[model samples]
Target: MSNDTAAQPAYFIAHITVDDVEGYRNYEKGFFPVLKPSGARFVTYDDNVTVLEGERESGRTIMIEFPSEEALMTWWDSPEYRELAKVRQAAVTTHSVTIVHSLPPR
Candidate 1:
């Protein structure tokens, strides 16, 4: 495959605080299925407990790798996923989403 075709271009990290743990668990369980149709994949979907920090945080951290910026946007705007996002917005009090480009092949 050509580099353009084979290369996945973006990494996204999310720092989140869930207001309702039960609701967040339900939301987490539902995310992958919605994302699968858009061809997004997770590099890490770690909960806060395993994270080492000065203080324990009450939230979740997620990292996802998308095939491209376009792919990431596609997933974000997808009807299926967008609809489900309400669960997250309602449950999460504070959150951050960051996207960074991957280093291209030398």
Candidate 2:
């Protein structure tokens, strides 16, 4: 969060199918510490995900909220997360990772 702020909130949505259970557990063990530093907050984790529309893989859903899009990107592109992601990369098949920005305040 920069001082000269013109930032809007952001949400990260991810849909994934676990490929290796043990690997995913390992990934989870290392996930939070890396995530917290960026000021992003976990919103939800759904195992019984219901897809109401369109064609998309349905297994697990994860949502994270950030103070700003920049903060989300910073965490996403950080070396720590990148390195930790190797575990997650090997653990699951990611269907989507969407970034939704909040509408500007009126």
Candidate 3:
């Protein structure tokens, strides 16, 4: 999809500090089913994260790549995800959730 960057890909970043394993598991159990329809790609998650520069809020990092910002938002804003997010909210301290766009095609 076109944007100010003219068709740049979008990525979602989640900085989370999980508090209740069972609660996060509850959220994780349903994550893929909701994520599947959006065509979002799970990049990876890092539990051993290091901050090279500025300080960060959490130690766990999760990333997902999407074809476009619209696709990412569509999945993120859906009722299923909204409901599931509550489970995550109860389980973790989410430092930040950010959407970033890649550089436009070179």
- Please identify model 3 stretches exceeding 4 Å from their true place: 1-7
- Give the total clashing residue pairs for model 2: 0
lDDT of each: 0.78, 0.88, 0.88
Candidate structures ordered by lDDT, highest first: 3, 2, 1
Better of 1 and 2 by lDDT: 2
Every model: Cα RMSD to truth? 3.6, 2.3, 2.0
lDDT of 1 by residue, 1-106 (tens): 3566446578778878878889888888999898887667788766645645566456777888888877888888888778888898888965678888876666
Clash number for candidate 1 = 0
Candidate 1, residue 55: lDDT:
64
Clashing pairs in 3: none
Query: What's the true lDDT of residue 19 in model 3?
Result: 96
- In model 1, residue pairs whose N, Cα or C atoms come closer than 3 Å (at least 3 residues apart or on different chains), thus clashing, are none
Q: Rank the candidates by TM-score, best first.
A: 2, 3, 1
- lDDT for position 50 in model 2: 68
